[model samples]
Target: MAGGFRRSGQQRQPKLQGKGTLEKMEREGPFKEWLGMPDLYRHTLVIDGDTYTYQVEDAELPFAPGDKVVFRYKEVKSGKWIDRNSLGTWIDPSTYNQ
Candidate 1:
């Protein structure tokens, strides 16, 4: 699926409120490892000068090289794995002012 905005199903309540492309920050520091369902297709993302490939259920994410994503994760102690869902607003590096 091409990167773009995605509308949630009418049945479920929307978690995020906004229109157009939204951006968020990852102030929690770098992630140890990215996680997603195996069946989901993987997408490439660049954050903090690092290239990371991630798989997400929603395809409408505005992800591109050199973009920052606020990564949210769930720690699983029993399985010995870090599961996380990418969050935050998508920011275009080109447009970001230093």
Candidate 2:
């Protein structure tokens, strides 16, 4: 799509990943404890002084509480933690301001 829109397949559609780069968030790393609620999808991440609300899949990773971090989404006017990756997992935003 030229409009930067992705045609999300059916919700039940399976994701065929061969486990090279994008592995399941649960087995990714230390932040695995922040896995999102699969059925509820409501997750919250407070960084700096702002609260970000976003939905995540069952096995996906949600934001974590930290001191200083970099969030790629500056336009969260929609009151939702915008998904920059669309993989149900946002980037690792634990890096402090440098």
Best by TM-score: 2
Each prediction's TM-score against the native? 0.32, 0.33
- Candidate 1 per-residue C-alpha lDDT over 1-98 given as tens digits, one digit per residue, 9 for 90 to 100: 12333464235322332112222312222333346523444444444543344444544555543444455433235321112364555556787996
**Runs of candidate 2 exceeding 4 Å displacement:** 1-40, 59-64, 67-71, 74-78, 84-98
What candidate 1 gets wrong by more than 4 Å, as runs, is: 1-39, 63-68, 72-83, 90-98
Task: Give the Å shift of residue 94 in candidate 2.
Answer: 14
Q: Worst lDDT window (10 residues) for model 1? A: 17-26
What's the distance in Å from true for residue 66, model 1?
6.6
Give residue 47's error in model 1 in angstroms: 0.9
Tens-digit per-residue lDDT, 46-97, candidate 2: 5434555444444345433332234333343576353544423333447445
Give the C-alpha miss distance for residue 64 in model 1, angstroms: 5.5
Q: Give the TM-score (vs. native) of candidate 2.
A: 0.33
User: Which pairs in model 1 have colliding backbones?
Assistant: 23-89, 23-90, 24-88, 24-89
